[model samples]
Target: MSLEFELCLRRPFTLLAHEALLNIYYSASCLKKKAGEFLRPFGLTDVQFNLMMLLKYQSEQDEGLSQARLSSMMLVNRANITSLIDRMEKADLAIRTPAPADRRSNIVKLTGRGKELLAQIEPLYTKEVKRIMAALKLNEQKTVIEMLERIRGNVSEINENTTQDVSLVRA
Candidate 1:
């Protein structure tokens, strides 16, 4: 059954745009739910895993990311980052060290354990994404990506006057 069929709407949508919007929203909700379930076995939430991924890349430079920078990168506020960093530090997945030059600031770094977790889960995550995209042909995937970018641009343009870029939207 198609997404529309699965949705069991009271009546057919009058506009293609309306149906398409609902389809995208439903698809994203379904994908996020499945992904969350998949991550459960690994003891990492999606956000924590994303944070680890950021640290993994940054660690290559031998420089830790400051807490403020990480907050921006994660698109999380300071309060949430404090709790997230606390949990990750407790799990030994990451470490926060005081920046030498700035006593009040801390830098976040992935520990050996964090790298190991990413190594273990990366392949499965890759396979899962490939599996999901396999529902569409290569060209269809590319077309969808282009269409989504345009839709995103249209949406972002409306909020240009806001101080924050809409692109930094949290998951």
Candidate 2:
């Protein structure tokens, strides 16, 4: 369905650029909602699933990841990551231990239960993702990926420009 129709807009968008941005936002929100519903039965949130996947696929063998590292990788604040880890700990899905090199920083690792749950969920998750993306052909999907990358680059550039403008104003 067209974004305008889906949004029930009485009139056309004022700007094509704004329309495109809203389309992206709406699509992302819808996807997140669906994913949350899909994951809820498994007793996991989307963020937790993402964190578990990272730990499963990216962590060094038996070494785990530091909380700071997880925060940066997850694009979240340290406090948020800490809270997430705390919840996961309570659920026995993950554990935090003192980092070997830096006792002050905790290393987060998936527990055995966590690994087992992920192993069970990953295949179903992959299938759901495939079903979602199957609407777009492989080439179309590739193009979408490229376009989104460009959008991200543009956003970064704009952010830098805005920061510089703010600093100049202050100066």
Q: Score candidate 1 by TM-score against the native.
A: 0.84
Candidate 2 lDDT, 48-83, residue by residue in tens: 999999998889895789999999999999899999
lDDT of each: 0.88, 0.95
Candidate 1 lDDT (Cα, 0 to 1)? 0.88
Off by over 4 Å in 2: none
- Per-residue alpha-carbon lDDT of candidate 1 for residues 102-154, written as tens digits (9 for 90 to 100): 97999999888988899999999999989989989999999999999999998
Off by over 4 Å in 1: 161-171
TM-score against native, each model? 0.84, 0.97
